[model samples]
Target: MQPPTTITRVLVIGAGAMGSQIALTAALAGHTTIVQDIAQGRLDAAAAQLRESTDKMVKSGKLAEEQARRAHDRLEFSTDLEAVAAAADFVIEAATERLEIKKAIFARLGELAPPHAILATNSSTIGSSAVAGASGRPGQVCNLHFFNPVLVMECVEVVRHAGTSQATVDTTVELARSLGKTPVLINHEVPGFVANRLMGAVQKEALALLAGGVASMEDIDATARMALRHPMGPFELMDLVGLDVVDYIAQATYAATGNPADAPDESVAALVRAGKLGRKSGTGWYSYSR
Candidate 1:
């Protein structure tokens, strides 16, 4: 077992957009990073995406060529969860944003991972307590919520639930720092903790405005970018994040908090129902080239 002072190996469960990026971030930070998924296709796609992103960064001068090369070299792909988890010093599950699914994953990790391993989730809406109890080692399970596009984003929310130990929080905070992220410590667990809560609130209000005929989607986005100085308007950001993802987060948050205002409006629901999922599906709040 590696010393508690350092995490030499990192395991990222899931090979989806967020998971692959999280693994890449860990690898680039000089950790041996293993990314596992249930399907071989997802693992293959993740490898391809990583290669493309690494090349783009090198070309854009955001990353040194040698560094990008080394990061790629450090990453390993697998379908065997137990084998990878057993070897991992830290495990980050960037799987679907559903409470039950997360709990199941944590339960398995608790059984397989080394006693000292820290189990983390990259969930946006769910709190750590939702799965920490299922992990068996609640003190070692916390939420290390890395933002989408992990390499580009500088912020990570390190959340501590009621059962989370101070040592676990401290180690996770240092882990975030090592990955070049500014870790925001959240002492209490809350649905949509910090940034996501703020963003979700804005999205909820923005959707309400559109549903009320207060403004056109374009006008609302324009106002945010021009008047509010937001990097991208709410609708644009939603589209980028995927309407399906937005729908899931909104629904999950509402279910957890029982806040009617947190619910997604009819427009968001309709789009998700129609499978206009966003950039991935080629259409959502706006159209995109496939």
Candidate 2:
């Protein structure tokens, strides 16, 4: 089958924050987009979040009211993976950051999606190479990692593994641009890709400083913002991205590399154990009233 030159139908598997935002981005770009999840409750939550996000955009004058309405109209939410995958021209697996879960989804997508469909993942840490083999279409599988708050983040990492085809990489880059994102191509697969790897280094140092009593989290964050000219300190950014997510990425990296230094910091693990999961949970390095 000839590689798909254009993406018209998009299937986003998993209706959490990242998945929902990705579906919305496709719909806003005028693609027929469906957000699929196993749980109806998660789909319901995703739909509500999409509505709230679009409304905020409209209110902020970033999106026209009519455009937002049309984008919403283009989006569909469902629990039927087979039906959606069967019809999708592009399938993006945005499930939890677990290798097993992603491999399972790709295995299914490999069986269900059209031959020309390009399967991608929104994983922040786990490289697509680890999951691509299960898809039975490694040439068409790549990582399309989007940052948190997908609508606002301009950078989308288009990562290609060794088996990924040039056509697939080009098509994925075009797709990212169509969604109004700036695509950064990573010719080789690496843990955390580009942005996250740099961010991870900063996070590790920040955690070490906090552990050593070199400074408070607030002071460290202040140093980053004031001295490094970063918008948010590493700790504050981790909170925004969700501490649980940070920990998960850390664990995934350590598992992939088997390096103790890559493991989740003790402080992060302790907070996650206590259910303090950052902004989503209303607390992490800092507390938020929710």
Q: How accurate locally, in lDDT, is each candidate?
A: 0.90, 0.92
> Candidates' TM-scores?
0.95, 0.96
Question: What lDDT score is found at residue 63 in candidate 1?
Answer: 95
Clashing pairs in 1: none
Per-residue lDDT of model 2, residues 30-95, tens digit only: 999999999999999999989999999899999999999999899999999988899999989999
Scored by lDDT, model 1 comes in at: 0.90
Error of 2 at 181 (Å): 0.4
**TM-score of candidate 2 versus the correct structure, residues matched by position:** 0.96
Best by TM-score: 2
Model 1, span 150-201: residue lDDT tens: 8799999999899888888889999999998999999887777899889988
